[model samples]
Target chain A: MADNVIIEAPMPGVFYRRPDPEEPVFAEEGDDVDAGDKVALIGVMKSFHDVTVDTDGVVTEFLVDNESEVEAGDALLTVAPS
Target chain B: MFEKVLIANRGEIAIRIIQACRELGVTPVAIYSDTDENAKHVRLADEAYNVGGSVARKSYLDGETIIDTAERADAGAIHPGYGFLAENADFARAVEESECTWVGPPSDIMEQFGEKTQARNLMAETGVPIVPGTTDSIESADAVREFGDEHGFPVAIKAAGGGGGRGMRVVERDDDIDSEFEEARQEAEAYFSNPDVYVERFLDDPKHIEVQVLADEHGNVRHLGERDCSTQRRQQKLIEETPSPALDDEQRAALCETARQGVAEAGYVNAGTVEFLYQDGEYYFIEVNARIQVEHTVSEAVTGIDIVKWQLRIAAGEELDFDQSAVEPRDAAIEFRINAEDPSEGFEPMPGTIESYRPPRGIGIRVDDGVDEGDDIAPFYDSMFGKFVVTGQTREEAIERSKRALDETTIEGVPTTIPFHQQVLGDEQFRRAEHSTTYVEEQLDLE
Candidate 1:
């Protein structure tokens, strides 16, 4: 059984899946990510802050939709340790 | 007239602006965060858009996002009601540079008055009496002590970019000046992003009086009398009333005149407020609030003028229809701020779901609020849920009416400042109008 870890938003802002509109998503479901891998970005006050995953895991699902408003501590995605 | 006007704000003031737009036959557009999805303003507006997250920085303060929303919604104008980006010169300039009209004073005027030292200097140049202090920012604590030595102790070291008593420190003696000055600078930097500070002689037991002024592009400026906001706790106003019982007729006329002249000299347009500290029959200019204030309702009630509607009309290039002589203040009016705080618990914020909410209603009473029963008072924003205003023919009548209205109000699930307001109405000193700015902290013990 895989150990599931929920990734939460570090700050309150609009959660974006990609770095820019023309850029591809940093990670997707079923992709294996290393420790300290960038998973998302939170855009607020005219700036974007990187949201990174700490532990090595496989991205299982995105809990919140792309470009959705999120609060601090709100779950953004779910990851299973590989 | 604008076909659609976007209100870049939330809460009661947003509702107020929406109503004004409706009366003017302009569509109202609302922008909300995640927490304010079900807010009253959102429901009332003709069009609503999601701005950003729950916090102000992500939503209300995001000028680029707000402008983009206005552009997407095809709004012809934007009304920034009071807080958030209302006083931001950059946001004002952005709106100016955009297709949407900015319903506020010119950006240059905002920049001039945004800094306290600059405002003081402008008022001084216009012959408006200012508090004795440095007209420029002090570089070190030694500068503060030197000013104190000349002006006496109990001096106030205030942040140049701060207002509403956020970045102010009062040093009573020589020993505390250095520490207070450093603390004031740090707090100012943290809050206003500006570490520059200026020193002024702190007046003891002074009346907090402010004059409302309206100016148009046609170069006409008029004063809308004054309001006494002396009932304050920790420099936050709890109650405000017009035709202050403390000022005589002669003094009131002079104060209003000075406010008009000072703003006109600065080339200020649209609605603004000039605040003053009055003591011993003398009034000194303090600062200018370049945006519409929360207590503007009090002045509107007494003068029979719709200030919000006028703000829209002024922004649309309308001249002042009425002159200063037409601005007549009739009956006395008082406004009570009903905030989500427990007065008994030292006014700590107690945000929660309002299980039951019933505001007072009847003749000589008006209630302006943003929440309904079963609505959650989010901790992400200001704790003020409503404002109750009462008006009567005389000051005594207004006071009595306020007591009756407060008693009739009901709220559950969260502690309110209603109890504190009740205690104040029943106090003899408050009844006699003997209270000053420090009255709430000194005379009344809520515990």
Candidate 2:
């Protein structure tokens, strides 16, 4: 079986879909990604932490929305193994 | 009584308020910040509303938005559980100005007691012994030194308008007065938005005791004995217990009476706490908490008094049902504040996924928690995950039970104060009741 990947939040924060609202998203559905790739940025009270993909895969669907508040362990994106 | 109450807080307190509402047969409507969508409080409540952003200013502290949500949910009263907007005088006024009732004290009473100096002056008039200090801010280090000489050594310089651990300094000797005074004043300005500082005699090795009092609209007021909260770090209480090990029967009676007299004189109503610092044989009045306290569960555990329900009843214009003598605290109770902090690393807040969490359960152990096993401990809000409250037949039994309870509680994926609590419980000084307010800091060397 292919390694089905799930991107999870590294910390509790507001999940920003893109670096900026007007900018293009870092990862979207069907986007190809490798291990250690940047997936999203999480904004806490005053600091921003980044999330990365753990396994090489093609992004299938975004589990969370842009600027959605999320806790640690919340899924950010789902991916199909390449 | 209110048919529905909106809990304007998050975390353990929200869960606590929700439980209270349920027991009273009132619907509990909980408001959650963006960070708290899956929080335990939200799940436990009758109805949960999304307030706003993860930041407290945009969510929990957004009084207008919260009130709007309350109206939309048709809540009859608002309970601002401790912290967030709990002690905010303006928030209390806003609730009262709205159609709904505020479950704590009246805003006016809050305003009067919010300032430490004002409360000190008010309580002094009622013959409640207060720490010998200047009423106004000491303008300079020279002023602090002069006050210290008159009051004797070890003077405490504190911000006139400060609470928590901010803007406070204990000048052990005359040489340290200038630097400590300046640091305290600067911190006061930075944290509290108030730069004024005052001086007072600092008692060495004092036990922190606070009396829980409740008053109703019908003019009935009573004290619920005293709680010893000497185990603290950075002025934040880590553990609290009822029927202070340090106080004898006479001292307990005297302290309770003094607190009642002080509250009566202040024209206070509703739930409140009169805090005092007891040193040697005398007790000195500290400030008053104008809202339900986090440690109130310990009092309830021993006294069988549901404080939150009474807060609602008192706000609804009902008289307190019990008399002073009618209230007798049985057994001994202890409360451990479980904060998401790395106790090994200077107690820095360690917010992360709970991964696995299991609250201790057994006879006489009650857990008031805000997060589940899979829930994340949000760093955006207060670090307190919950509290472990335990009660037993005697102080020793309570201590033993508390130790077992702490050992049984397992919180993963983040450091917690559990280890510190375990160590404290096992310490010889604590077991022997030889610990003072400075015990934790001195033993840990937090400073």
Candidate 3:
């Protein structure tokens, strides 16, 4: 748990855990994820950008609320080694 | 006509609808997000209600909340302008079931045109030429390849449930089909909540032409001519104009008639736009925008028609009081989208407060904006805050006037698309009408 990494938003916009409103969240807390897996998306200017995980880990916690405005470098989630 | 109408949207379009309602002697009600407490729309509205939080899903996209606001305001009709819930057939259906009338096409027609594949099929059945593509959604890359094999490479995979360039990808070679198709599918799922996609022969270079059609509930359909939206980057239009320089008089008549017939056959009503892609000498029906669009003002300027006013009238069961011949667009017009994006920084969104705002004014310029000086530009919404529509006797005159209008226009504090528009207006190729849909991406430096 000490070796954890926090992912941050690359730009400003609304962040979404689920791909769309009705779809299931890409990953939930305590769920295992691999590198290159998209955990969320940053919605901006009628476009969507995938926020992919950079390392294999278990999602420890989501740091930001879904569909909330997020700025660049804002902490999105915390991940620990699986 | 409605005694009062609720506008279930925000920004310049909301203002546009409010003006229309006022002109028709109807009270205009407005809705706002948490960040839009001081928005221009709220100030201009006879009554304003807060929908929800800053995020669109919590606010403007909340159909039930908007409907509730309409009820609270006692508005007789609801106008969903351009975006958010504008083309949502489910929302329109809900409005139909409610006490308020929906000020657009019927819910069934919206649903019909909302699904891209069904639209293509319907247009084809109605004798309108559709782009060479699948009338059904494709399931895999192999199916797309089959289409590419028959129609050739560089095929466009488009979302079946949405338009306006989202969830669309162009696969240039057979080797890139699998990856591109997957990306398009994922985007389709992300945006439209549906992964269904269809393949089409991607015209390498085509002029984007759309006809403005207004159909009354009584079956009178009139076309307000076509606009050439050729100057675009990444399938997003930057500038649009009517009486396409590329089309001759015969082609223009044929295209307008085609759109009118297509919508008439589909039993469409209210203000809608029929979009097409024109290449060589042929034009193909792409899709229909079942609500008033951003570029509708250009058509309005030339034809001297108040399309939004007509939307209210038609929704109230009034017949179109004019004939197709009487719907003559005398002059050419061009609309420039004033967006809060930096041309220097690759046209990136730079939303902030407008320290000072002054739109151009003169003989042939009309400005539709949602913000004034000192107003904050919300990042959560679309980048476009306003549009500067210019008209003149001919395309050359319109271009000349546009350069002056754009120069006279001034928006302080945030980076804008003005510089990019200014550059395009100066370009010889653009002035002479030689650009296509991919013109901006291939040629201009966005300076």
- Top candidate, metric TM-score: 3
Cα deviation in Å at residue B185, candidate 1? 14
DockQ scores of all models, one per candidate:
0.06, 0.19, 0.35
Candidate 3 TM-score to native: 0.83
Query: lDDT per residue, candidate 2, B232-309, as tens digits?
Result: 876889999988999999989989999998898778999999999988888999899999999999999988999988
Q: What range of 10 consecutive residues in model 2 chain B has the weakest lDDT sum?
A: B438-447
| DockQ for candidate 3, C-alpha atoms | 0.35
What would the TM-score be for candidate 2 when compared with the true structure?
0.79
Docking quality class, candidate 3: acceptable
Best-fitting candidate, scored by DockQ:
3
Candidate 1 on B200-305: residue-level lDDT in tens? 8889889999999999999999999999999988768999999988999999999999999999989999999999999888899989999899999999999988
Better by DockQ, candidate 2 or 1: 2
TM-score, one value per model: 0.78, 0.79, 0.83
Q: Name the runs in model 1 displaced over 4 angstroms.
A: A1-82, B134-199
Error of 1 at A40 (Å): 21
